[model samples]
Target: MATGWAGDNAVQDQIDATVEDAVKRARSQLNQGPSLTHCEECAAPIPTARRQAVPGVRLCVGCQEVRDQQAAFSGYNRRGSKDSQLR
Candidate 1:
């Protein structure tokens, strides 16, 4: 039941933290105002289905997919501490 230096339930804790951060980020974006009917980056029109499906989608399906993929690949040092940073 102990995970030593990693701490107990370290993996689960990291996952929960990531999910919570993501949810908070998404919610903040929603509070910014209504979603536009078109992608800001591109002139492409945002489909009605997408706007209704996602509360505050700023990008179209294609752009959203790319952003999601990039986010998933980005890494964060969850185990890093202030002491570690100093070193």
Candidate 2:
């Protein structure tokens, strides 16, 4: 049973919404249009194999790896559970 004013399915609904947001975020990060022959950030040559494998790739493997490492996740706390707040 849900406590307070939340419905029985409120927890599940919140989980679903959070998952949907993550999926949308991932999709938005995908590059569009034609793949560039050179990396946009480092100007390094983009290999034909990478360009063919990933359509519309803009950065070389090294640059892409760095960019991925720099990516941050949203800090929004959808779950108000005590355990979640501890983290």
Per-residue CA lDDT of model 2 for 2-87, tens digit only, reads: 46698889899999999999999989978898999999999999999999999999999999898777775556887979999888
lDDT of each: 0.79, 0.91
Error of 2 at 25 (Å): 2.1
Residue 40 of candidate 2: its Cα lDDT? 93
Q: Report the Cα lDDT for residue 31, model 2.
A: 86
Lowest lDDT 10-mer window, candidate 1? 71-80
RMSD of each: 7.5, 4.7
Worst 10 residues of 2 by lDDT: 67-76
Q: All candidates' TM-scores?
A: 0.53, 0.68
Model 1 lDDT, residue 56, Cα: 70
In candidate 2, which residue pairs get closer than 3 Å at backbone N, Cα or C atoms, i.e. clash?
none
lDDT of 1 by residue, 1-87 (tens): 755588679899999999999999977766255777998777689999978887677888888888789878745555568876555
